[model samples]
Target: MVPQLRKLTLMRKIKVDIFRKICTNWPNLTCLHVDFRQEMNYSLMKHIFEKCPRIEKLKLWTTMLIDQRCMELLSSLEHLSTLEVLLDKPHLTPVRLRLLTDACPRLKEIHIDWNYFAPQDFEYFLKANKHTLTSATLLWTVGEAQKTSVVPLLKQCSTSLRKLRLVYFDTPRAMETVAFEALGELHSLHELSMQYLSTYEPKLISRAFRPGCLTQLRRLLMQYTTDLLDETVIAISQGCPNLRELRICASYKITDVALSEIHCLRHLEILELSRCSGLSGTAMAYISQLPTLHTLILQFTEDLAKLQPSLRLIVELKELRCLDILKSGNIKAVPFGEFPNRLLKLRELRVTYESENDFTELQRKMPNLKISNTAWLTEDDFPKDDDADYGYRDG
Candidate 1:
């Protein structure tokens, strides 16, 4: 009866008969996200393709091995534009990718765990969808032998690709200067996220971007790289003048010098620095210079003394709306009473405090502000900006 239903998400598994019946009733559905545990067979996939003619986005989290028949059936969804397949078995290959991209030519966005496919497979997929693909999430674990020239493949779709996410489990050696040179060629890229694990050389990833290369970039996130330098941040600030959101996590090498350089980004709105121990609170004066800043997150600093002075600088962010200072148990409770009415726009504040009165007093002072004493806050805990595209968030 719900024929007008346009979107649906099912986190839990459903019976095959029930799924088919639901699909039959919601023929106009354009988006579907379902956990197809054991019910993902050719017949079920066929029913979906036949029933949901308007389906544009499809996410299948399954335990079954995806076969050629399933791929072929998915190809029949001519309206499909975004595809996400999280499977227990590694069944996505270059040949399968060709089937989907060739048949469903409208498909432009893909979200997949790159661990399921080889480096060559990824290359082939990018080359195949180079013209139409706009967004891609490449999440993989790097093996020593798997180091390949991925940036060049990404550049093939530079004119069309807008958002890209690269997450590596075991980061390899610092990329040669040539690799980042190729990455800078993505002229149309709007958002980029690079995350690494067990990274030692602090300057490895920073060398990836040269000033004035990624001019179109608006949002950039680097996590656990420990590989950013003051020069790199300065280059980013000078090059990407329009950048609005910037987040760097676990970067121990970035000092107050780099933080001072960020004042060049006049359009910057959100800045998050997590576990960047090299920063002294003195650089906070530079942050207060940003006229457009609304959200600030300085998390996981071990030294409270270094942060106490920085807290005073935050009052200068007249446009500030949200602030999070949650650290891993090391941060002692800091009273919010110090933040006066100077932060007129401030509405939400998150911190780790032991006393209940600290929360009560802050609420009493700023009746409109919402304060949380959460011990931990993840990316999901913070609400995303309303204007965010491609699931990019300030958090």
Candidate 2:
């Protein structure tokens, strides 16, 4: 063992008292990750700061509200570069959040997923310290003043902002209408995702293609926008030509014409249009022409399986390596006989049907392909991050 080659890292699920001992034993620990239930208060945080001064990364998931006291304790950690905090209680006020950011000037990334709805303090925080933040995810509630003023506030981070996520992390049944606009000023953003819970949004995006807004964007995800129409798809294809990945789920109003507008995206690699009702085989007909597309997921889109020609059009996507057609109404009824020639590049396929599904011939086609039904893995494969689960281990 070399004297100067010591590297310290710890990711485990231990009682607080045991964790305190571990911190005491290794004062040079630079990275720490615990389960979501790890309790934190002034006393625990005080001892942590005293013992683990060299820590650079921290993740804590709590079931309590992050009020001023917790903010004060977190503010003392000045060298933190990445922080992720998921709270059970909502409402992180603007003043306290500003205090935390001001206290830690070097923080670059923060991702928080909370229950209920988020307030407008996050918008205020963005306006105040836009330069220090390079990536942030702010999930807010539905407020008239909050929704309209949110996009304009992102302009403050235009200089260094690279990643941004504005989504709804509300309860399962709670839905709120939100209108999206003013993305033209964020030229530096490379990844932008806007997810909502409401399907009745008047218009997903008012005007995203005004020439300069999404010019440098590489990935865009718009989910839960049930009213996403053909015009909006045209706006995305026209506005952000540099996009490599796009996901639009649960879009009810999108038709074949909307997907035809996406034909201009020559550089697109990954695309997912799950549960879009209005689009029949027409969208897949055009999507198969994309030369660079590698992955496609069109789960539960029954309209796409209208005819045999429709299913045949998908096999034309020779570049596609992964395809998910699970729960898609009747694509299986089309008889491809033995399917031994088409889908040469496919490596993975997932599908599910109500009656007997004959995978015998489908397996003969892509002998090397991995196929599975459109269902979640066993509980042991990926454990939940609750009291009993430890989640992912550090790499």
Candidate 3:
């Protein structure tokens, strides 16, 4: 058979050297996901370039070797359009970035997760391939350099960029230090995801959604961004009317007002507001009205009473699919009279309570629904003392 391969995803657990053989066999392979713990030899990597010349989509794991020779080999692959690399010992430098992008003119999506120094040549890479890049994910070791590295890249690629994910690990106030105004300038951007494991400034992030900016944005994900407030939610609801999916996990300041503001987003398909304290029933009422919502996650609410009234309105959501209210203390006992009128499509439901009776009733009534392992959580089980483990999913 002619070597007209297109994609190859291989995870190496064995010590045997089968990868080199596979790469040599597939000369026309376009996409390759190599998640191996073993160190890759230069000759084997070089042979990949020589043999699989058409390898375009490349995703490598954290421990894989990518030395200077490997970079030389990478520079030979001309058809690469998407690249995701998790760097370990040998950090990703701009020189190597330039080498790869210079070789691959069609490279459009670049996702780099590094625990090393911010690549000094980041801006140069952005400038050279700005027109071609539409989706980019840049993650660096925890520090202020993240803002420095990201701000300029966004500025350079503002015109053509459509999707972006910026993560600064264990860095508190990374978002506060960056130029949020630069994000607003990217008019073509449709999807955005921001992750700062330690801390992130939501007010500054909200500034990016002012009126004309991000009007076409469909998806917004801010994991562990606890400062997202009503003001920002209102601004997003106003500016990003086309918003489809929103995830605000472990946010502190968000309340009923914020949900009320975003309830009118007619196009919203998925909403996840987990571990948000200080909410009322009024907010849940607003969420019930979202016409297009398919997946809703309101797990671990501070006040269970606030979520109870909204349970009745949830049945009104004809399109609702997955609902997660686990650890919210909303269901001490399953209410037989207050069951959803029509949950024909409801596939997965998670609740935190120890009751075989509850599970049995739910199963008997809705045979299609999959009630997962009961999360027997008491008030004492709530780890308010440990912020790190507070919202940690049981699964």
Candidate 4:
């Protein structure tokens, strides 16, 4: 019998039972993820930690309330290398965050989903754990008035951080100077994802790409507003020499000039230009010329005819593996047979059309192709609208 086959609703209950069984029968359990709605009672959490002494990776999703016993148990787990916590509350008070950090001195990576927290509490956590923290993800919901404090905390931790993702909510003005100033100090940073709230300004975004601050950065994701200009794009290409993946979807202002600037990224491999209404044939040709480009995504563009002329050159990109041309209402025609057979390396293809006949014709031309109707796909099938929003554009 499997111990009466209990139905566990909470992650904690499942973890407790599984680990208890593992300790009794197996010698080691290395990884655990707990998704529990309510806070874990400290003693029960400690018991699980004591059982899984060899655990190296731990992921916890819990309510806002701090369980001191759980914290104490976590502190005793000396081998923890990766810790990811998703908190239901808006913020983790500084003291509780510090306690967790202090317990895991050997932690190499930490990801936190902070719902509500004081700006200084984050600063204190950074200051206390600066030496041990190498990568951090902070999802913050901050007000307009509290924006100034966010950057200083980031700047303080930038020296030791290699990857930083700052997601802001309801605080656009904070995206300006303070954030960039802190970001510029991150000498070792390789990846950055910054999503600004409604208060984002063009100047602040431009400043983030200023040369020398992001010398080591290879990947950058910016989610801003339509106010971003061509200068910002130029500045980014010039600043990050090793950039390999560039996703600028939903940027209504991107034009031929901005597209041309992307050529500066010699190492670029993947480029996504979805929902960019200003793209033209010239822009498409320029992108097709990227020597290292393997994957190209152009979804929901307003001008499909502009891209039609460049399709031949695009198919000639020998290294191209995946192409997504979905939701371009302007693409009235597709030269399915015209594509060079030499593009044998192509693997994945996505297109959107209302007519089943059009899809059938496309499938007949490329028998190995995988086609998806964007009209039928749900939001989960594609990146979220807000995640795809590239607000910066050259007006």
TM-score of each: 0.85, 0.79, 0.82, 0.78
Greater-lDDT candidate between 1 and 2:
1
- Per-residue CA lDDT of model 1 for 1-395, tens digit only, reads 77799999887888889989999999899999876554678778888879898899988753433466776787788998998765344433423565676678798998764334556556666777778889876553322265665676677644689987755433345554445677788888888876543344544445456676788889987756566778878878888888999987787888888976788889999898878888776767788899999998877877646755664676788899988777634444333456656788888887777887746766888889887776454653321211132223111
Q: What is the lDDT of residue 49 in candidate 2?
A: 67
The numbered model that scores best in lDDT is 1
Strongest candidate by TM-score? 1
**Which regions in candidate 4 have their CA more than 4 angstroms from the true location?**
1-27, 36-39, 87-95, 115-131, 139-148, 169-175, 223-227, 306-312, 330-334, 353-395
Q: What are the RMSDs of all candidates, in order?
A: 4.9, 6.2, 6.0, 5.5
Question: How does each model score on lDDT?
Answer: 0.70, 0.63, 0.67, 0.63
Q: Model 4, 1-395: lDDT tens per residue?
A: 33322222234444556555644443366676666454356655666667667677777754523654555577777778777666444334432555556666677776664444455555666777677678776653332245444555666664578877665434446345666666666768888766443335656666777788787887676533455567777887888778887777666676777766777788888887777777676776778678788878788776677765765567666777777887776555445554537566666777766777866765676778666765344543332122332222111
Worst 10 residues of 2 by lDDT: 386-395
Query: What TM-score would you give candidate 4 relative to the actual structure?
Result: 0.78
**Candidate that beats the other on TM-score, 1 or 2, i.e. the better one:** 1
Pairs clashing in candidate 4?
90-115, 90-116, 91-116, 172-199, 225-391, 228-393
Candidate order by lDDT, highest to lowest?
Answer: 1, 3, 2, 4
Candidate 2 TM-score, C-alpha based: 0.79
Error of 3 at 395 (Å): 21
- Arrange candidates, best TM-score first: 1, 3, 2, 4
